[model samples]
Target: MQRLFNDCIYRIKALGPEDSTKLFLSRAFGSTNGSCPMELEDAMKKVLKKCGGLPLAIVSIGSLLASYNSPESKHMWERVFKSIGSEMESHPTLEGMRQIVIISYDHLPHHLKACMMYLSIFPEDYVIVKERLLMRWIAEGLVAEKRGLTSMEVAEAYFNELVSRSMIDRAADIVNYYDGREETCRVHDMMLEVMVAKSLEANFISLIGGQYEVMPYDRVRRLSIHGGVEASKQSSFKKTAAGRGRRKNINAMNVEHVRSLSVFELEGHKLLNQLGEFTLLRVLDLEDCKVIGKKHMAHVCRMYLLRFLNLRGTTITVLPRELGDLEHLQALDVRLTFLEGLPETVTALENLECLQYSNKKDYISDGPSKTA
Candidate 1:
């Protein structure tokens, strides 16, 4: 195998990288999708020279722009054409994720676009449990109900499409949580930023931080808000549902299963016990909620089912020692704090796998702390 690989490398050197790429594509997608794989190869070929030779770079950017069509979407295109600032390239040959996510957003069918944008509620790199995210999407009416398709099933279908398109990435873990588990998702920050911007432009009320009220509870999932926002970003954001155009009565929700709930802050209210109400919570993130205190967390920590927990920027340094009770904890994203270390009780969580160490770095470790 080594000899064969070496000989092939030698032959590829003779064939050159560009031709080699062509040959590889010719074999991979040949006769699969109507046109020859080179059809995409040729399209990418033009971008390759300009974008250097990074496939991801060219493809990410091209795919992002492939389906852009809207009065609002047109504004973004104008930004590109007007020589607007773009982060679509890392190296001369590398593709920028900003462009890729945006392009992916554009090409989505109207329904799919609504579903994808609804997912922007979570913070960047925040893993979303498939079931929980889908439920919210359904609550927001993003999924079109079909005969024989349960709401959960419909949600999974949407997720599969996004995965197939590479619009959203799947974790390396084989255990992808459908109804909520520690298997949360990690999405790019740029995608969320664009969604927030568009939401603002479209009168979609954003509920990040203590900025907005949970109004018009009816069909409130899509043009909705996240658990909370960052203190740094709070000043730039305001608490307003005006971004969301109309208003309707809060729909009677049965709140069946919940995967993740991130509460940042409660503004001047000074206190909130919202999390304790959640029983099936998988990922509970309250990184910098200025108001919440130990009193509020008395019952919050008892969620033995929790998998991911982020209390990074908050004043409370030491987590409730009871956090050890979570026998299912998998990933914990808490950094830049005064807390000493995890309680020995952490060993109870036999399923504990990835512990996210914050430095703006997303690493997936093996057991306790290995490396991605």
Candidate 2:
């Protein structure tokens, strides 16, 4: 195999000590060169040695230590160094690198940990929109209110911190034109692997479609269905006798405890009809889903605890007049849909803080308008 594709192959080697140290410092302290205070130099050296000149290990360990880079936090730095156990020495390959990344995850703050694990809900290589993600986080109660900061502000800080730590990467060339701020991000593949593993271990989320087709054994908490061509094929096949059994199994799954449900493709639109089953749901994100019409809004109106509802890019014509019954609704996004207009009942939503919509002329509403 190597002989046949020798010309196409490129052998990438690990970074040298000098370059590794530079990368580590750049990530740890945002320094151009490998520079640190005298108090932290010893601790940094001890941790860098274990990285074995590998870029991934260095970045992971460096970002983990960034929070403890102050002179007063010398003991914390030493503690981090000691925590990189003997497994790193025993397995000095990809396993060791995974261990390094897991260490970084292990050191995240409790709220940040929940937020990070939520990234696993997205499909592999999916570009996540910052505003959409923050709204969901807020609806899921993952973002705690600070003394002076709004919940959205706190969630933004959580996102920036994750970017700073290299847990998620800011998408290049994808800036919001209005504010010139980062609007999209993608999780690193390795970091995403860690997140998915951790999410499953804790039963934090239940996934369907995509690479994961089996139903989870535990009660659903947060559900994400990533549909694609395969799911479309499976949906068609469900018309057969064998497929009917599978469909029944899916319909029987409990969703009463689910707080958030996000479906990414048109194939999963059938699940939207069962919204009545998600009694405690707070977020219902069905971005870009097609074939769904105003008939489904009946189930949506029944969700009294819903805080965020996204039907962007769907084929819905209008919302139900009973939409006002969702007293806890805080945000509603219908951008890029075929909706003619919002119902007058929308005005009755005292808690609605964000009402995003677009008209036939493609005129988008400004962000967070309560009066809409």
Candidate 3:
């Protein structure tokens, strides 16, 4: 344990005020094309003074300034300066930095808040794929569907918005998908911490890792299970003929309130049976999981409230014909699975807009034709 502790320790110091200011300006107003605007220089100075050389605080303030584009009025910057100073004076600690970040979060438009908080579901330093992330957002009903815009298009705009605000960033190595858009991104560690804090405060998600079990104040609305060697050893799975089977006591908590569930890289058969206890689930993601079979699809078909179901990268070969019972389903992803073909009942899903399968061409079926 002492060796492990020693290995984890790293000695470093915080940036000085001058360096902090440099980083702040570079992030907040850096233009590859030109210099900072002379008109906004004084306001930027005021912002730097209030930041107190804290990098996270500086970045948070810079993100706010970067998003502000209301003709660059002095009064506008004054409001920002006064707000940060007031919050800093009141808190006067690292908690003050937290307050600064929360202010930026609060200033976001209503629709973006959930999208930001959703970032908390992924593990720290997780490399997020834009395609997968957008699908998840659409599944959770976070993306607003418009007549002229596809949900993926709308989600891409939201991703760009968060990037512009410094909440998320592209991975170092860029890989463009078939559409020529970069598909991978990651959240900054500090911002990820803020997301986890806010997610817990709102009971919006319950995250289960290694041996840490977090008890929520009420029903957990969403659950994310991250499985690893340590997590597997720590889990209370019943021994089966195949191996140690994973199971969660969903009945002990407010199972009826769980709206979303994501399990990463675990065998899902035993755990999937627990869905009988969840009545309000709309999103069920078992991406990259192992050995999910046809019997599991039986329970899934009965989940009438389901709007998004993803079985990507699993061993499931066939989707049950009764899947049509999930009349509310909007997005179904079966890519990279063992499935031969979609059941004919899928044509019955009048509300489904996105159908991703293993075929060379992706299917974007508009809701059943009104003329037909």
Candidate 4:
């Protein structure tokens, strides 16, 4: 592979001071050329110096400062400068860039912090759908209800803010030409690392797959399952004494308090069979898991506290008749699934606001629903 790809490979060099300044100013003040007011020039120089000529660090810190009103606010500039630890300058490595990203995360508003950390639930390089993420945020109560704006509108604003801050990257290949909005996004690997660290520190989420295979001994509040059945099985048990000891099962971990659960593996149907343990779950995202079928849907119907249920791209042909039991359900996404029609019991969900499906044939035509 190396011999075949040698001619195609190219290394991106770090930006020099002048180019770094231009990039920083463009993100911070929307300047066509790199220019700053005289009063804040010193602080800007110091901030840029800490960025170490890395474009990612420059843009992240620049966009973070942009949130504060007035570029002329030397106090705000100095405040941000102070928030970045002196250790970053001493290190001057990729670790320094990671610190810069963490600083930006630290500056996010409380509500956005929760939403941002929640992004850690997704696997690295995962293409996150905007509407789906917003629904999850709303379900988790991460987005506050504004006086005139719906929860979704509030969530949209949050997503836009995160994008503007360069905390999340828009999926360049996916766009809605009619609306001129990017439909998907992905977190930069570095940013995801910072989010994962923060999520682990706060115990805000527990992940099972990839690099996060060890389950925390504490109560699992929000769980995200990644990888396939084998990965799940591996994460569910731990071996001791040079792999000769009896396997210890993680089923003893308390799960009744888990409020949200997301499964990204195709064989997540096995996990769904245990849904009854998570009685207080508010969000259940099993998107693109094709192995899920009617049997799993039966368990899903029993999640009485569920507010958001995303079964998009599953193989389930029919929703259970008891779907209406989830009176608190706010969003139900069955798009790209084998389901021909929603159960009539869906009409009984009084709080249902967003019902997303792939085809008109899936709708009953008697209630308010949002189609994909």
Steric collisions counted per model? 20, 0, 0, 0
Deviating ranges (above 4 Å) for candidate 3: 1-7, 10-23, 30-39, 50-56, 69-72, 82-97, 145-147, 172-182, 229-249, 267-270, 359-372
Residue 254 error for model 1, in Å?
A: 24
Give a tens-digit lDDT track for model 3, residues 1-372.
011232584322456766876777667667423345677777777777776666667777787777563445667677878887554533345556667777778778878889999988877667776777887788888999889998889998998888877778777544324223435888876577788889888888887643334455267889887546454554255223123322443334566778898876463345566767767889898876675776677878888999889887667878999998899998898876777799999999998988888832343432321110
RMSD of each: 14.4, 5.4, 7.5, 6.4
In the range 1-372, model 4's lDDT, one tens digit per residue, is: 011232575333567888988998899888847568788789999998776677888899889888663655889889888877676554456566777888899888899999999998988777887888898889988888789999999998999999999998887545332223437888998899899999988999887654555667477889887655334445334422212221132354577789998887553445666777778999998877777866677778888999999987667788888999999999998866777788889999999999977743453433421222
Report the C-alpha displacement of residue 287, candidate 2, in angstroms.
0.4
Top candidate, metric TM-score: 2
| Superior by TM-score: candidate 1 or candidate 3 | 3
Candidate 2 to truth, TM: 0.85
In model 3, the worst 10-residue window by lDDT is: 363-372
- In Å, residue 46's CA in model 3 sits off its true spot by 3.3
lDDT of 2 by residue, 22-115 (tens): 9999988989565799988888888878777777788888887788778989898887778776555434565667778888998888989999
Point to the candidate with the largest lDDT: 2
Winner by TM-score between candidate 2 and candidate 1? 2
Q: Tell how far residue 9 is off in model 2, in angstroms.
A: 10
RMSD of 3: 7.5
lDDT of each model, Cα atoms only? Answer: 0.48, 0.77, 0.70, 0.77
Which run of 10 residues does model 2 get worst, by summed lDDT?
363-372
Q: List the residue pairs that clash in candidate 3.
A: none
Candidate 1 vs 2: which has more lDDT = 2
